[model samples]
Target: MNAVGVDVGGTKIAAGVVSPEGEVLAAVRYPTPRSPDKLVETMVRAINEVGSGKDVAGVCLAVPGFVLAQKDTVVFSPNLPAIEGIPLKERVGPEVGFPLTIENDASAAAWGEFRFGSGSGVDDLVFLTLGTGIGGGVISHRALLRGAQGSGGELGHVTVHATGPRCACGNRGCLEALASGTAIGRRAREAAVENPGSALGRLAARRGLLGEDVTELAREGDGVALSVLEETGRWLGIGLAGFVNVFNPEVVAVGGGAMEAGDLILASARREIRLRARPPSRDLVEVKEATLGPESGVLGAAALARNTDGAYALGG
Candidate 1:
C-alpha cells in the first residue's frame, strides 16, 4: 500500500506519497507558515496535493519537539513554537480524508533508516541528526523505543559534560550544546578570535560564520576551521560513546545538515567510541552517515501509516 508522509519542519513543509517499497511517488514542498491557522491550511493543502488521485492508504506527520502520540499533540517545539499545543489530529484528520498519525521527526527518521537507509540490516539502531540542534532516536530489537509520553529517544539532550556550555533547552552540557551545527558555529567564532590571521578568522571578520561556512573553510584546508570541526566531533564522540554502552546498537547513523562535513566529524567520533566505549558493544557498533538524508522523516512516517479501515498504532 502507499501512504503520504509529511515532514513539518520549522522552515519548510515537505509532503510525499510513498509506496510500500519506500519510493516517493509524488512530493510537494512549501515554506512553513508561522500562524496556527495558516500552518494547518498549508499542511492540508500539501497532503491533498500529493495524495490526490493516488492510492494512498494513510498519512503520517513527522513533527519536531515533544509529541504526545496518543493525543496527537505537539507539547513543545522550540523551533516551531506555533505548532505547540495544537490538536493536530483533530485539526488535520477531517480535512485530509485519511487515517492520520504523528511521530517525532527524529524517531520517524530513525524508522526510515531502519526500514530503508543505514540501519536496514540491523535489528538495533541509533540515529542522530546534527543541525541547528541535535535530534535523535533509538530503535531496539526492530521496535522504535518511544517513552510513555511518546517523547523518548531524545539522545541530544543527554549531558556529555557536566560543566560545559548551556543548551537551548536551558540545560547545561547537553550534547546539542557541544556537537550540533550551532555548536560548530559557536566554536568557530571562538576559534576565529584566537587565530586572527587564519582563513576562518578572515571570514569571521568579513561576516558571521555559519556551520556550513566552517565546513567550507575546512574543505579549503583552513587549520582553524578544521580544529573547530575536530572539537565538535570529539564532543559528538563523547556522546556516542555513552550511547554505544547504553543502547548497544549495531548501527549508529548520523544525518542532517552538519553531516555535510562527512568523515571530518565522524572519524573523530569513531575514535572516541573506541577510547571510551566498552569492549564488546563498542567493537560491534558501526557509526556511519545516514543514506536517506533529508527524506528520512517523510519516508519513515509514510511507512508507519496505516489504511483508514485498518488499525494504527504509535511507535512499535
Candidate 2:
C-alpha cells in the first residue's frame, strides 16, 4: 500500500503519494494558508487530491515546529506562529481517517535520507539542512533520537560563537544565526554595500537580490561573494565540529539551497571540520551533500507512515 506525506513549509504545502521504495507517484501542492483552520483545510485538500482512489495506508506530516510526539501538537514554531500549540493529530485525524504521524521537518528529512537516500547504509548519521535557517536531525542504530520533551536534534541552535549575532530564537551566536541562508544573504548584502566595485555588488544590483545572485557570482569567481561564502562555511564548520565530536555519526548530509554554491561553501566546511574535529571523529564521518534535494522531507514522511504500526498511534 502507498502512504501520503505532507510537507508543510512557511510558503507552501506539498503532499505526495509515495511507495515503499521512496518513489513519489503523485503530488499536489498549494500555497500554505495563513490561519490554522485554513492550513488544515488546505492540507486535507492536498491529501485528498493525491490519495484519491488509491490504497493509502496512512499519512505522515512534517511541520516546522516543536512537536509533542505523544500528542502531535505544534508547541511552537517561529515561522508558523498562527499554528502554535495546535493539536495536529486531533485536528486532521477525523478528516483523513488514517493513522497519522507527525515529525519536525528536519527530522523527517533525516529519516528520508536514512531510509532512501545517501545515508541508507549508515546506522548513525547527522543531517543539517541549510535553508532559510539551519535545521538538523540525528539517527543512531537505525532509530531517531527524540530527546527529553521530544525536542532532540536541534542542530541549528547549537552555539558556535558566544558573541556573534542574534538569532530569531532570541539567542546570540547560535549556528543558525551565523551560517544560515538568511545569514549568507545578509552578509552578501553587506558586502555588496561595502564594496560597490565588486562583482557581487554588480550581480546584486542586476538581480535586485542578494541571495542566489551572490552565490552565482561567487561561483563565477567574484571576490566579495567568495568571501561571504567562505565566512558562512567557516561558521557552519565550527558548528559541525561540535556535532562531530559529540555524535561521531558515520555520515553528515548537508542539504538546502546554500549548498548549491557547491565547493564555494562545502569545501570550507570540510576544511574547518577537518581542522577542529577530533581525529577519530573526523576520520569516521563523511560529510556529503543530500542527494534527495527538496523531496527528502516528503519522501521521509511517507516512509514513516508506511512503516508505522498497524494503526497510527499518536505518541510513542
Highest TM-score model number? 1
- The residue ranges of model 1 lying beyond 4 angstroms of the native Cα positions read 309-316
Least accurate 10 contiguous residues by lDDT in model 1: 307-316
Give one digit per residue, the lDDT tens place, for model 2 in 82-118. Answer: 7777788888877877778788888988988888898
Task: Give the TM-score comparing model 2 with the true structure, all chains together.
Answer: 0.95
lDDT of 1 by residue, 90-209 (tens): 999999898998889989899999998999978999999998899999999998899999999989999999999999888899999999988998899999999989999998999988
Error of 2 at 167 (Å): 1.2
Off by over 4 Å in 2: 205-207, 306-316
Clashes of 2: 1
TM-score of each: 0.96, 0.95
Q: List the residue pairs that clash in candidate 2.
A: 70-315
Per-model CA lDDT versus the true structure? 0.91, 0.85
